[model samples]
Target: MKFSKTLINWYSINKRDLPWRKTTNPYYIWLSEIILQQTQVKQGLPYYDAFTAKYPTVFDLANANESAVLKLWQGLGYYSRARNLHATAKHIAFDLGGKFPNTYKDLLKLKGVGDYTASAIASICFNEVTAVVDGNVYRVLSRYFGISTAINSTPGAKEFKQLAQKLIDTKQPAEFNQAIMEFGATQCKPKNPDCDTCPFNSSCIALSKNTISELPVKIKAAKAKKKHFNFLVFISEDEKTIIEQRQGKGIWQNLYQFPLIETEKATNFKSFKSLIKDHELLTNQDFELLLYNKEAVVHKLSHQHLYTHFWIIKVDKLPINGINIENVRDFPVPILIGDFIERFNF
Candidate 1:
């Protein structure tokens, strides 16, 4: 199709010279794809450098400790991705003898490697003629062809993939795939797109009919439920803060954070004090709420919005039960708590 030629021509001159795009190294390609998920280019660039610099090979990453890996991925949300990356690296290094999977099916067998990621690595690194249909390709294809099916729907995703496959240049799959992705990201943005400069503007169904913004129909995501948390930053007599490693199945599982007390609703001052008074953890200690940290940050996840109230409490001595205080900083904590510590010198 002419779409492939047009896109490759444009990409040869306009595509961003990203570091990951400079080589066909499977490990670097895999790292780029994982980091780019749910993250913008500007945000993921530094992380890409840090990860590649620290662990130059699959073996290096495979042998790294989980805590060390999570610490590197602290600020980046979606801790599961980091864990999966570590696991996948270990599998490749130990099980496969440090050689990364060379095909799409092999890549898909690894943890956290979904269809999109598999296609990306297969085509970009190995020149496999697999279509890479990401958010950009979805938007560009749906709008250009005026497909109104919800992008997240099963049939909708399949239809888009077929259309993308038709446009992929079999001879130069890597350049052609990247070209379309770049075109969608730069010109056919979700907001006011630069249709005047877009090469497909004349033929684009959305641009011709003046419906650019609404062409890529998508199912609206469910509303996030509110969760109120009262985090007590208990500073011990020896200046250690109480921390615990989260275990079992739940949000933030396998991560570390300060001791938490969740409530059905937001607690007022009186109720908060009363709840602390009745709680067994603080009932026997000489704990006193010293100052209320005014800067309460709302951390939003895909399905939950956590409204955290940080209370700086002073305890004459640390609690001996239900909490671990020794070498708390050795374990990796959540980024929210890290930000709190940075702000208040905790």
Candidate 2:
């Protein structure tokens, strides 16, 4: 039997009954695909259900506020996905006149709808013959075909995409796509793959040679830049605190955070006092620092490590320029900052 047929046969009997698999609605399919991009299936399912339940259709998502969308996606991280999802929904609702794109080519034109995502939505929802080549599929094909190209490089992506397209079973496009991905997810996993039980184990190159762990070659990742941030949490007598929402492009875009001072070196009390005084931060008198906490939390991003310090300050009045008195729970904040608030409670 051919690889595609064998894989589909295996999938029919062994695939997990996921919530996304039950529906052919492109909106929900797109939601699942986007949520599952950087997240594991187990972690992503609840988020998928939450989003779909809250915003049932593209119109619902498109009509929602950016803050509300970000708030719902608070803990999920990789916020660009949420932002793009919203943008795409709006495009569909307004420009496309509330009609979700049904074809792979049309879906690809939407914001953040890359080849893999477009293909997944197209095949699963419309039965289009589009190939989806994600990390799992990359691993499966690299090992099966004994391809040595670095998976992240341009040449590697092109080669794998071509293989995926050629190997796709046109008659059962949806099943073919799902099976290859599911096979990679369950049996041909990144680490400790269960080759003995896999239907393709008999002919799988990596299994035959003990190269399963090494087949999916990846180039070394660049080192993450380390940056330090000292957050000043100014609390009024009424317990309201000063906060500001980050604006413009870059990390933590449009997320609410407390007043912060970033420094290359760890900030000391004397330097902080001098710096604030230089900036004329306080109006009349020097604000007294009640207590200084030594604990520094390290939040890791894909390309950076954020070393954050929380300084609690009690002030007679809030800063007139940079601070806003708002409920922290009501605003959209990054998950790391949210965790910081929960841990400190101020």
State, as a TM-score between 0 and 1, how close model 2 is to the true structure. Answer: 0.95
Best candidate according to TM-score: 2
TM-score of each: 0.94, 0.95
lDDT per residue for candidate 2 within 107-180, as digits (tens), equals 88988889999999999999999899998999999998888899999999999999999999999999999999
In order, what lDDT does every prediction score?
A: 0.84, 0.85
Clashes of 1: 0
Q: Where is model 1 poorest over a 10-residue stretch in terms of lDDT?
A: 320-329
**What is residue 172's positional error in candidate 1, in angstroms?**
0.7
lDDT of 2 at 340: 74
The deviation in Å at residue 84 for candidate 1 is 0.2
Worst 10 residues of 2 by lDDT: 318-327
